[model samples]
Target: MKAIYHILNLCSFDVTNKCLIAEVWCPVNDLAALRGALEQGSRKSGANIPSFVNRIPSNGTPPTLLRTNKFTSGFQNIVDAYGVGSYREVNPAPYTVVTFPFLFAVMFGDLGHGVIMVLFALWMVLCEKDPKVKRNRNEVWRLFFEGRYMILMMGLFSIYTGLIYNECFSKPLNIFSSGWSVRAMFTELQWTNETLSTNSLLTLDPNVTGVFNGPYPFGIDPIWNMASNRLTFLNSYKMKMSVILGVLHMTFGVVLGVFNHLHFRQKFNLYLVFLPELLFLLCLFGYLGFMILYKWLAFSVRDSRTAPSVLVHFINMFLMKGSGEPALYPGQMVVQVLLLMIALLSVPVLLLGNPIYLYWLHHGARNQGTYRGYERVQRGSVEDLSVTLSQDMEEGFALGDVLLHQAIHTIEYCLGCISNSASYLRLWALSLAHAQLSEVLWDMVMRLGFRGDTGVGAVLLALVFSLFAVLTVSILLLMEGLSAFLHALRLHWVEFQNKFYSGTGIKFIPFSFSLLQSGLDQDVLIGEV
Candidate 1:
C-alpha cells in the first residue's frame, strides 16, 4: 500500500461535444501509474488533451512539461483571482434568498392568503415531475422542494404582518380606531366558539347568551368594521416598511462589497466603496428609529441636563419629547446638535477603520510572497523560465459586465419590491375576495326571504347558488395564488440574484468521470482516484 494524500485540482479537457466541454478536478495519488496508463490510452483514443506545464519546482533544470489543458487555463483564472482576493469567487446566493421571507411578508401579508400560497407552493413540489410543467418547474420546484422550509416560513411571516396590518383579502380592520372592538376580536379568537359575522347581528338582542351560545336574538354578523372603502392604512404602512427595509437591504449590499474588497487585497478601495452606503444607512436608521418612538409614545427624550438629576431627570426625559412639537428652547437645540454630530461621524469612522486594517493585512501578506518571489527573481532563476507575459489585453470596465450587472439589479429590485408588496396585497385582494364571495353566498341564502314558507323548488335553487359561489371563490384563491408564486420567483432569480451574484463560477466537478487524461495528473489529481 502507498501512503498518499488526495486533493481536488481543476483540469480542463475537450470532450466530444463543443457545447458541453468537461472540466473536473480529481484525486488520484495512489493511482499514479493508472493515471499514466489512462493518459496514454486517451491519446490512443483520439481524446483532445491540451498541455499545461510549469518548470518542475525542483533544483535548476530545463523547462519540464506537465499535462494540463485549455479548460484548466480558464479554471486557473478563477482560482488565481480568488487567491489574490477578487470578487468572492463563490457567491453568497443562499444567504441573500434567506431574507426573502421577511421581504415578501412585509409586502403581502394576510394569514388566510398566506395559507393559500403555502398550499400552492406545496402543489408545485408534489407535481414537480410532470413533463409539461418541467420548463416552468426549475426555480419554483427548486424553492418549493429544496427551500420548502423557507417558503413556509415566509408565508407565516406574511400572516404575521397581515395580523399587524389588520389586512386580509382587502377586508380591512381598523384595530387602532376602536380599542374595544380590537379587544373583542382577539378575545373571540381566544375562545373556541368564535363566529366571524357582522356587528349588527350581535347588537340585535341584549341577551349575553345570544352572543355566544343560542341562536342569536337576531342572526350572525361581522363584528369588525373596515375604516376605508378605498385605500387602507395597512397597505400604506406595508409599502413604507418595504421602502425602509429596501434601504437597509441595499446598505447591506455595500457593506458586503467592502468586505469583498478587503478579501481581494484592495485595501484602499474598501473605504471608498463603503462610504456611500454607511452614510445612507445612518440617515435611514436614524429617521426610522425616531419615527417609531414618536408614533407609539409621542415621546422624544433628549438629554438636556449637563449633570444627572437622578429620578427627576429620568421622569423629565420622557416628558420633554412627549410634547409633540419641535423644541425651540436653547437647551433642546444643544442636545439635538450633539446627537446629529455623533451620528454623522459614525459613517466616516466605520468606513475608514475596515480599510486600514485590510491594508495592514494585505501589506503583511504581500511582504511574505514578495520575499519568496523576489528571492527567486533576484537569483536569476525566474527570468530564465520560458514564461511569456501577455500585454495586448483590452483594459477598463467592459460594457457588457456593467450592463449585465445594472440591468439585473434594476429588474430584480423593482419586481422584487412590487411582487413582495403584491403578496401582501393578496391579504387584501384574496381575503377581500374571500369575504366578498362569502357575502355573495350569504346574499343568495338571504335573498329568498325564506321565512320557512319556501317550496322545494326555491329551497333547491338557493342551495345550488350558495355551492356555486363557494366553488368560484376556491378557484379564485388557487388561480391568484399560483400567479403570485410565479411572479415572486421571477423577482428572486432575475432581480435579486443579479444584485450580488453572477453566472460566472465554474461548477466543481470530480475527476472520476474523466473523458481524457494528462501527465499533470501526477501532481494535480494524485490522491483521490
Candidate 2:
C-alpha cells in the first residue's frame, strides 16, 4: 500500500547524470499503465515543455508541474532547477514593463536621449507582436515580444529620467525653451533666457566667457545669469571625476557584499570580513583631511592647544584609522616600536574606526549567521571548496573561494560603470556634432546660390550635396551607436554578474507521464475540478 501510494503521488521523473539511468522499477502488470499515465500526465501539465539539461536529482519531493528524465551516463556538471509553483501562472505583462524599466532608468537616466530610446523600445515591442511587420520571419522578434514588459519598464524609466534631465529630441534645451504652456506652469523655477544655451554660438567677446557662451540677443540673456561659473572639479577634470565616482561605486558594491556575506554566515570570521568596503571611504578621506589640517596648523605656528576645535583636531590626528589597517611597518621597525606605532596609529582606526565598523557589522552579521551557515553547508562549505579540484571545473577557480571571485567582480563592475558612463559622453558630444555637421551642410548649400527657381546644373549640385550629408550622418550614427552598444554590454557582463553570481549550479528536472495516465495521480487526484 505504501509503495503504490508513493508511485501514485509521483508527479515527474528525471534522468540524473548520464551515469545514473532511471530503472523504472515496477511490477510487470503495471508497466503499460505506468507508461501511459506518464505520457498523459506530461501532456496535460505541459511537463518538460521548456526542458533544461539534466544532471543530478533535485533536493525535494518533485512538484506536479514539471519533471525530468534520468540518464545512464553523459556530461559532467549538467543539472536542472525548475519552478513548480502555480503562482507563476499569474500574468507577467502588467508589472514587467514597470519593474525592469524603472530599475534600469534609475541606473541610466538621461533626459534628451531617453525619449528616442523609449519610442524605439515601444516600436520594437509593438512590431514584435505583429507578424505583418517583417517580410521574413525573425527569431529575434520573440525576444522583443516576450520581453515587452521589461522593455516597457525601461521606456518609462527613460521618460522619467528625461524629465529630470530636462532634455528631448536632438536639441532638447532649445526645443523645451520655447514651450510657453509647460513653461508657464512651473512658477518656482522658470525657464528663463539662461535655459536657451543649447545652441549658443561661440563668441570671442570678453563678456562671453562660459563654455557655451555666444552672441547675445538684446534684452534677456539667460546664459549670463545661469550658474555656469560654478566649478565642477570632477566634470571639468574627467580623470578626477572617475576616481571619485569609482570610490563611491566601490563603496556601494562593498555594502552589497557585506549583506551577502552576512546572509551566508561562514564560521570563524570577523564581522569586519563581511563589512562593506565603502564604510571606510569617508574615514579614509577624513584622515587625509587631518594630515592637511595638521600641516597647515604646524606651518602657521599656531598653538596646537589654542587651535579652533582642538578636540576635533586631536580626534582626527590621534584616532584616524581609515585605510583598512593602520600603516604599520613603514619599514622594519623594532618590535617594540612597531607595537608602539600601531598603538599610536590605531587610536583613530581602532578606537573610532573599529567601534563604528563593528556596530554596523554586528547588526548585519547577527541576522545572517544562521541562514548563511545553512547555505554554506549545503553548498559544500566555502573553505572545502577553495582547495577542491575537479577535472571539468574551470582551471583557476577553486570550490570555496569567495574573495578572489569578489575582487574580480569588483573590477568588472568598476570597469563596466566607467565604460557605460563614458558611452553617454557621446550623447553630449554627438548632439553638438550633429548640430555642427548640419550647420556646415546648410552653409555649403547657401553658398552655392541655388535659387528656389533653379537651372539643371544647380539642381544637380544641390541633390549631390544633400545625398552626401545624408550618407555622412547615417554612417556616423550606425558606427558610433554600434560601438557604444558593444562597450555597454562588456560592462554589464563583466561588472554586474561578477559580484553576485556563480552561474554554475545544476537545474532540476522531473517526470510526470505515469502520474498523468493514472486517474489516481496526485495532481488530478488533488486538483480542483
The local distance difference test score of model 2 is 0.37
Per-residue lDDT tens digits for candidate 1, residues 372-462, read 1112111121011111112112232233443343344434443443344333333344334444553454455544445455587577667
lDDT over C-alpha atoms for residue 47 of model 1: 61
CA RMSD (A), model 1: 14.7
Off by over 4 Å in 1: 1-92, 120-154, 166-232, 284-289, 299-529
Identify the candidate with maximal lDDT: 1
Candidate 2 local lDDT, residue 141: 62
Per-residue lDDT of candidate 2, residues 1-529 (tens digit) = 5334544444344446222123332434556776777577667878555322223545432222223221101001111111121211212122222332443443334353455456766786567546676443577665344444444545566567545433333223443233122333333344456654653632222221232233232222222223343123113323323234334433343444443344444322223332222323334432333434444445332343333442243243434322332322233124323433443443333223433433333345445763221222224212222322231124533322344443444444434443543443433333334334433544554445454455876787778667654644354333433343343333323332233333333232234535434655333442311
TM-score of each: 0.44, 0.41
Model 2 TM-score, all chains together: 0.41
Q: What are the RMSD figures for all models against the true structure?
A: 14.7, 15.6
Q: What is the C-alpha lDDT of each candidate?
A: 0.42, 0.37
